[model samples]
Target: MTNFSGEVAALAAACLWAVASIVYGKLGARIPPLQLNLIKGIIAIAFFVFTILVTGELFPSITILPMCLILLSGVIGISLGDTAFFTTINTLGPRRALLMQTLTSPISAILGLIFLQEKLNTLAGCGILLTILGVAWVVSERTTDIGHISTAEFRRGIVFGLLTAAAGAVGAVLSRSAIANTQISPLWAALLRLSAGILILLVWASFRQQSTFRLSSLRNSKVIAGTLFAAFCGTYLGIWLQQTAIKFTSVGIASTLLQTSPIFVIPFAIWMGEKVSIRAILGVVISIAGIALLFYL
Candidate 1:
């Protein structure tokens, strides 16, 4: 078997997630983000369990400290960060929301330094910046009139976006802290984090007097198919690749590569019959250049 680098894994995860996002964009019109998150999470967990059983992999005995850290990472990253991102998308629209998403790379870099004492060299740091710049440029091409939103509402959306970025960064940093130098399998780590996130969402739903067990959407065959595909691409395989990337690379590099999802989104968008603009094409070129620099320069 050829040994693939962490960079390859991260890039693949980004591509899968980009496709998942395109699918979810159509479904988001009908389903609430929280409920969708829980549903997909449950489905993904089922697949994860099946993989574990088929592989005959025994669960590792993890200590409380690492377990707690990993669980917290999921709660912060998936539970809170994803929810906040959904809210931002609703408030600010996907374009602005995607612009805000670029913040995660730098925030992860900073958090990685503070928590893991990980430092990037000059070229790597430049690559991160160039990647972010490319993604931001591609995503900020919307002209939606936000005049209807009050000043306070606009500010609230900005705050939510910032929180989403910070939570995601902190969560990944925590995962690094918990699993660094450990014998934990990336698949198992992903399972634990996903379970933690789903548990947290269930608890929050209960507290809100909402039912997390609603299955009306499952009745529709198309919806079922879309959900399963999203779960497989976005949560199941996407997360496993994310864990593998984190295990083999610095969090900064992993995060910068992962944020290239926007670049991948461009090709998918064109496939979906959306018109591709010159600026978006330029952004893709810039992002590819940055990735090349990160790996080769």
Candidate 2:
């Protein structure tokens, strides 16, 4: 169990992110993408700080370079990547946006090979490929819920989705480099990343003369609750798990497992009264086979 802890963490993170995405889809209707990113960052930062304090984990002494890498990872991944993802969600709808996210696995794998010199064995490589294939297949299925999208919107979504995938890949590799051989706790890493991301987001919001703290849409209790829940699950815990995955596993494996959120979303969709097709079911089976290979191989 301990040997595969990273893989497990990555899978768990995907599940939490799946839940968060569902809540975030509703919240996106009421809030702008950047502001939504900022709001969740603030909420998650509070949780990170509280957890660090309660655990009595003092900030570890680290050299400047790794610290800088982590901070940059936060800005790129959380600030830019998340904003692009939210925009993708709005423009393309959650299904297609998630399909776009499937690109992250291969992108991160290539980045890992080039920058980090990390390589996976043949079987592990096959597992990653199968997992990505399943996720892509599942998310590409059309549903009645998705309304009509114009050509311009579709094109815009594709661009942002690609951007999101690139940013996420870069960020993950940077993060993996920072903590792969270090004494940095995943909790602390998550905190630093969230802090840097939120800071940048706040500056960007101010530069645009946008309200930095005005959350009028959150006036509704349900919205507030959902936002808080999503922040806690997705931003706080999910990121910690992600960092843990990067720390313990190869970047390619970690990234591929993280991209399994779409597979996890299947049950959530069913519960929400959305219809699942035979193709989607087949995709899930393939993904599960991939996950099994990853686990037992």
Candidate 3:
């Protein structure tokens, strides 16, 4: 692979996730975010099983260090992070909720420095601001005027989205810490994450008395299909690409590009005739420029 091949991987991951966003939007209308998350985790676990067999990794060979990192990543990112995101997307819509994700890069960068001793620079700092401002500009232009719902609803969505971004940033930083260790295969790490996510979700559901053992995911085909597809493409493959990207490049760059999925999302929205304003496009451009600037610095 080339020096920056991981970037391509990350970008690809973003593209897949952008598609998943639409699915989640549709799914969220009917199912709860927590329930959706649990289903996605189950689907991801299934994909991980296939991936392990195809990659030819000895499952027994995984070390405790890699397992710990993957488990942490799964709980933090998949379980907690995605649950918040689904809620945000349901309440705020994908275009708006994803705008908060542009913060994931800088947030991860700062955390990486504090926790992993990664270098931080001025250009990267400025780039982070510009990117966030750009995304915010597009999504927030209507915040003061949107009359579809009460102010409380908007606040709740934005708050949940922000929380999701924060948790995801922590997950990205943790993944960087783990990848820097270089003792684990990316596929194996991904498998562990999916498995851990399913375990966590199941444990939570059981504690809450929301067992799938009695309920049929088949009864809710659309949500099940959407969540399953989201898991396969977003959780399994997207995370695979991300782990590879983190292993190859600076976490800052990888995260900046990965979170650029909203750029793709805007076009998807427009294609669906959702009446997108020009500000949204502009914001996506600004965030992309910010990503470039961060890489330049």
Candidate 4:
């Protein structure tokens, strides 16, 4: 049971992210991507600090090296990666943006194999492949409302999307390295990473002369509620579970499971009266079969 804790945590994180993404999509139109990312980071950081204080966890004694790795992971993964993701969503729409994210699992797997020497067996490899295929298939489906974009903007979005995937993979592997080699609790790890990410965002916001906290945006109750809810589910709890998954499992398996968030979005789509196609259902089935292989074998 303990051995499977990482897998369970990863799946749970996916569910939370699925919920958050829907909220974020609605909020994104009203907020600039950088501002939205910073806002959520601040909110989530507040939650992390409160959690740490309540749990009396304080700061765990961690070596400077592991601490640095975690910080770097946050800078790359949350700051750069998430900002790029938001930009991609704005430029190419969410479906194409999410399609680019399917690259993370394989990239993480390869990185883990090279850097951490965390090789997957034949069965696990097949699972990873199938899961990636399923996710790619679902997100690549054509929609009636595809937005028009200039070729230059399309190219830029593609670049940012790839950057998002690469940064995510690198960040996951770095977090896994730090956590697997240290005694830091997952909660503390999350706090440290988010703190680093928020710091970078603050500096970037300052350099651009953009206000970090927009009281105007908060004036709207809907925006405030949505931001807080999304932050709690996606940034706070989602990252905590993500760190736990990295701590308990190989980066490859953890990343593969984390990438299942898109699959979880299908039920949400149906509940919202969005039509899902037979292709999407087939993708879900394939993804589930792959997930089962990861769990049972």
Tens-digit lDDT track for model 3 on 13-88? 9888888888888878777888888777777777878767887778645566756876898788878888899998
lDDT of each: 0.77, 0.82, 0.77, 0.80
Best by lDDT: 2
| Candidate 4 residue pairs in clash (backbone atoms < 3 Å) | none
- The prediction achieving the highest TM-score against the true structure is 3
Residue pairs clashing in model 3 are: none
List, residue by residue over 168-280, the lDDT tens digit for candidate 2. Answer: 87887788878988899999999998899889998898799656556689899998999999999989999999999988887657766887887788788789887768787
Candidate 1 local lDDT, 224-262, one digit each (tens): 899899889989999999999989886546766777776
Q: Give per-residue CA lDDT, model 4, range 1-297, as digits (tens).
A: 257999899999988988888788778788888898999998999998888788887678889999999999999999999999888877765545665676776666667778779767788678768866876676555554343566677678778888898998888778887899789999999989998988998889888855655668778999999999999999999999999998888755776678777678778877877777888778766765665564345
With candidate 2 superimposed using the best TM-score fit, by how many Å does residue 267's alpha carbon deviate from the native? 0.9
Model 4 earns a TM-score of 0.85
Off by over 4 Å in 3: 1-4, 60-63, 113-119, 143-147, 209-220
Candidate order by TM-score, decreasing, is 3, 2, 4, 1
Worst 10 residues of 1 by lDDT: 138-147
Off by over 4 Å in 2: 1-3, 112-142, 209-214, 281-297
lDDT of 1: 0.77
Whole-model lDDT, candidate 2?
A: 0.82
lDDT of 1 at 4: 56
